[model samples]
Target: MTETHATNPPGAPVFPPGRYGRRREPGRRRPLVPVVLAVLLLAALGLGAVRLYTQYGDPAYDAQVITYTDITDSQVVIDFRVTVPAGGSAVCLLRARSSDSAEVGHEEVTVTARPGERQVTARHRLATSERPFIGEVLRCRAPA
Candidate 1:
């Protein structure tokens, strides 16, 4: 067996200044690549989310007013078009508005088509309570 000796000198501290009694500092700086990559990844995901919504998440039906005529004191005629999904039905709210923005007439029109037909066009004659300035299809939706 080798001879054993006391590890620390009697008049000196058990450890040196840099061991545990001094402030700790980083030896080498951490690389910035990981943080930058994380930020870029988050940005890419956010952009993808927005793109997905705009591309595939929008409401599909859009109603277009083709013509409106015969605006009498008690009636209005409107022609409009709407698109529908296969085997789907839509209820459109038709309205006639006066010059002062008062709603003079209102009705719900149901539109449907064969499974392969993607669109439907219709003419509506709304009976109004007073003279109206415009006839419009306010909104259309799929029925439950």
Candidate 2:
């Protein structure tokens, strides 16, 4: 018995004409489109970041919680420091949370720096309905 082999043409395999619809040719590459889109996306993100920082972030008024003590069922004492523009004042938002991370109390306190003073330490006793596990200074802003 003799073995025979079937030879096919080189290049893409041929299919029944029109059975799979028209074969699409490779399209032109538009490298510029992706580059342009990436540039626009970055520009949009930069603008958004700048807008948010201007609207919500302030370096002139900053607060840090030095310690949280005197935790009790009714209150927590939060000792914090606020840095404000020299001789300026700030309104800070303080918060107390229970062990489960639930906000139990929140308050706004005003801190003032005397002439030539840039930092002021403040202590606030926040009243809560339940026992608080931690306290913090949420944010500080120039008084309106």
Candidate 3:
């Protein structure tokens, strides 16, 4: 009979050819947490840009004279109403223009209202014949 050496080096593991005794099952499929987070981040960035444009970039200057009483050569006192969407506010800019549509004077005012109807008063000067128009900027919340 041939001699069979029965010696396994320390800390060394040997396994049969067809089976690794421990039978390692397929690893569990990990959840796609990282992918989900990346998608959410991209979506948030898009939404934030939209909000910024609506709030600061696009201001629908809506000027209405509630009361145009005090009138003078240098200044005119006129009470006006400012309207904006609920859950936000509007900043009114009184733009004074020259007869040739040149901006000569501009005054900014802030008005906040709930998610409904809000009425605010503003007074501006009629520096020139370029009739005054109201500019309303809707300030809203950004994406989380």
Candidate 4:
């Protein structure tokens, strides 16, 4: 006969074999909350990166002044060069206006210089009294 302690409740079995042991379901795991959170975080980061690229990391138009000369009779000549990132064409313009708000002139030219240094010459004639201390616009553009 086996010896037994007498603490069992009325009508209960004397010893329960697996009562105090922990049981695990091997194939049943927790839901993938952390994995879903990680994926959402990465997607947000990717969208932010794309927005930054479109907002601030884009290229702009490029140009420079090579030489400028003021001629007799209030005529000014300007030489400039421009470099385009992709396309290879440019246009030059000389704008002349009077200080007294009397006269205005816009001169346009075709520029065909290579990426480094192309020579463009533009001429403007202004009235002697209307020579602007605040001069005109010199614009360059990719050939359209």
The C-alpha lDDT values of all candidates are: 0.84, 0.88, 0.54, 0.54
Could you tell me which residue pairs clash in candidate 2?
A: none
Model 3 ranges with Cα > 4 A deviation: 1-63, 98-102, 114-116, 124-144
Q: Deviation in angstroms for 125 in model 4?
A: 9.0
Question: What TM-score would candidate 3 get against the native?
Answer: 0.35
Alpha carbon lDDT at 111, candidate 1: 85
For candidate 1, lDDT tens digit of each residue in 1-144? 332337544664344444466543437888799999999999999999999998877457768899999989999999999988765678899999999999999999998866888788889899999999999999998765
lDDT of 2 by residue, 1-144 (tens): 322223433554766655789767656866998999999999999999999998878667778899999998999999999999888899999999999999999999998889999999999999998999999999999888
Over all chains combined, what TM-score does candidate 4 have? 0.39
lDDT of 4 by residue, 42-142 (tens): 99999999999888763433556555457444655555555544434566555555556654455666655455543433333433433533334466665
Best by TM-score: 1
Model 2 — which ten-residue stretch has the worst lDDT? Answer: 1-10
Model 3 agreement with the true structure over 22-136: per-residue lDDT tens digits: 4454469777998899999999999999999988774443446566544444444556776544445766655544445556455565656655555555555545443433322
lDDT at position 22, candidate 4: 43
Model 4 alpha-carbon drift over 4 Å, by segment: 1-59, 100-103, 115-138
By summed lDDT, the worst window of 10 consecutive residues in model 3 runs over 135-144
What are the RMSD figures for all models against the true structure? 8.3, 8.5, 11.2, 11.4
User: What TM-score does candidate 1 get on C-alpha atoms?
Assistant: 0.63
